[model samples]
Target: MKKNTLTFIFAVGALIFFSQLSAQENPLSVGFKAGTGLSNYRLSGDMKSFTSKMSIGGSVGGFVKYDLSSNFALQSGIDLYYSTSKLDSKVDKSSNKLKSLGVEIPLYGIVQGKLGSGKAFIGAGPYVGYGISMKSNGVNLFKNSNEAGKLVMNRFDYGLGGIAGYDFDKNWQINASYQLGIADLLKGKGGSMKNHGISVGIAYKF
Candidate 1:
């Protein structure tokens, strides 16, 4: 219920932002992007049973940007991404693993500064994610499900993200970004799941 409410709020906010952008004189630009992402899970509190590891994946997304001024813009996008990680066991002989597919919606406010003919930009934003599907491979170290009789994997996550990039021209840009999950993604009571990743991608503006 909380997850659904948060998702609704973000969707409404994005809609309002885009609606306002439509009234501006120079409102819209569309683009295609592709990038590689690294994913990891972090454990917090008293998580003695969990271990952290890294996974490499990729993402592709389409974005619409609204130029608020010569120095600022509002950008929003939807992306499809995959992440994988392994959980090691210190006491047990078997390890648990996970693979997840997610759909992410990001809304960003970016500040652009000039560096000669090329432009440099920094952006920070909030992102909401829905885990479309997940697979548990490897061995099952935990034998019991949650209170709802569901596996301890959560289907929703929210996070903060930032990006630094340079535009060579109106149509070409490159960016490096990091996203940190601010919420606990695991459904069970014991461990926390967070993702931190670096991505490099090229964008083509139209």
Candidate 2:
């Protein structure tokens, strides 16, 4: 119920967000993008005492953008990303390095302006994600715990994202982005774990 509520709020919030920011409509464009992402796990709620280190991974995606005008646009896309980060506990003598692959659906409102002849853009939005794979030390993290018989991690991840970049040409773009995850990763609830990610990538419009 909590996860559903959060996703609903974000969906509604995104609609309201762009409706206000975009005044005029322009043409639509489609693009392909690839990049590297650095991610780390954040402990929260009952799991606040834990720690994790950042990991580098790959991201590939395609997007369609609706030009609200030369000054603003709305973008949506499907991104596939991977991450491997170490999670540890101070009180418990345990350390785990998790690797996961996930897909994200993002909706963003982009603000565009001129920078030295090229166009610069900054945007903020929300994303919905689903994990296709998650493992720690050769063990599946999404499976049931051997001793507890409860699921170890949740596959559903939803969050807010921000991005900024420059368009060197009508068909080319370079960008940096960050995603702050809001959903708890723990499935059956002994605690909470969330994800934070930073990515840099390039895009080619079609």
Quote the positional error of residue 23 for candidate 2 in Å.
Answer: 13
Weakest ten-residue segment in model 1 by summed lDDT? 138-147
Q: Alpha carbon lDDT of residue 61, candidate 2?
A: 92
| Clash count in backbone of candidate 1 | 0
Per-structure clash totals for the candidates: 0, 0
Model 2, C-alpha of 50: deviation from truth (Å): 2.1
Per-residue C-alpha lDDT of model 2 across residues 39-81, encoded as one tens digit per residue: 9978766676668889889899999998876687899999998
List all candidate RMSDs to the true structure.
9.6, 9.2
Q: How much is 137 displaced in model 2, in angstroms?
A: 1.5
Q: What TM-score, computed on C-alpha atoms, does each candidate reach?
A: 0.78, 0.83
Candidate lDDT (C-alpha), each: 0.79, 0.86
Worst 10 residues of 2 by lDDT: 18-27
Which runs of model 1 end up more than 4 angstroms from their true locations?
1-26, 138-151
Q: What's the residue-level lDDT of 132 in candidate 2?
A: 94
